[model samples]
Target: MSNSKLYKGSINTIILKLLNEHNKMYGYEITQKVKDLTKGELNITEGALYPALHKLEAEGLLDVEIAKVDNRLRKYYKLTENGTKETANKLEELADYIKTMQTLINPKLA
Candidate 1:
């Protein structure tokens, strides 16, 4: 699968899960974390990352704090109380999806 297409489906869950684990992270940090975790399999582009961050912020699932990092302004994202709950739900849903895909892909084994 194309990296763009794969990220399209998993970006939100990935973002939320990262925030859940790390408490807070900036955009570039999040992108780098994904790369590190996936060992370069998943690359998150600015085009996709910013929009998802905006959507999540608008939906009240994320809280943003702007800060000066070195010589640049950076916006850090963290999960709101609601976001924490939603993260759990999203993770559960993702797990279910993986299970379903696995079953379908290996029905004989299943």
Candidate 2:
């Protein structure tokens, strides 16, 4: 499996969390935000970003708005009602996972 595979499973959660914090964001914006936040440790590629966005939209957890910018259309994503709820749940789940990882990776911290 690819190194990015580990982060693949949490893509939705990451997207939801970002949308939860920011009202809406475009695809490239999201990628930049992640890179900036992680200090370039995590870079979200187009291949991984779009599919996850479409999946979340299809699942009714995300809402999209298209706007004309610089003579081009830009799609911005935000959390829907269900997505807001899901974001909270996903955040909690991520927190739990972090705790588990901490225990496993640094037992002294646990």
The local distance difference test score of each candidate is 0.91, 0.92
Any residue pairs clashing in model 2, and if so which? none
37 in model 2: Cα distance from truth in Å? 0.9
Q: What TM-score does prediction 2 earn?
A: 0.92
Q: Model 1, 45: alpha-carbon shift in Å?
A: 1.1
Steric clash pairs (candidate 1): none
For residues 18-81, write the lDDT of model 2, one tens digit per residue. 9999999999999999989988888888888999999999999999999999999999999999
Candidate 1 per-residue lDDT over residues 1-110, each given as its tens digit: 13867458888999999999999999989989999998998889888899999999999999999889898898999999999999999999999998898899998766
Worst 10 residues of 1 by lDDT: 1-10
Best candidate (score: lDDT): 2
After superposition, candidate 2 runs with Cα above 4 Å error: 1-3
Model 1 stretches astray by more than 4 angstroms: 1-4
lDDT of 2: 0.92
lDDT of 2 at 24: 96
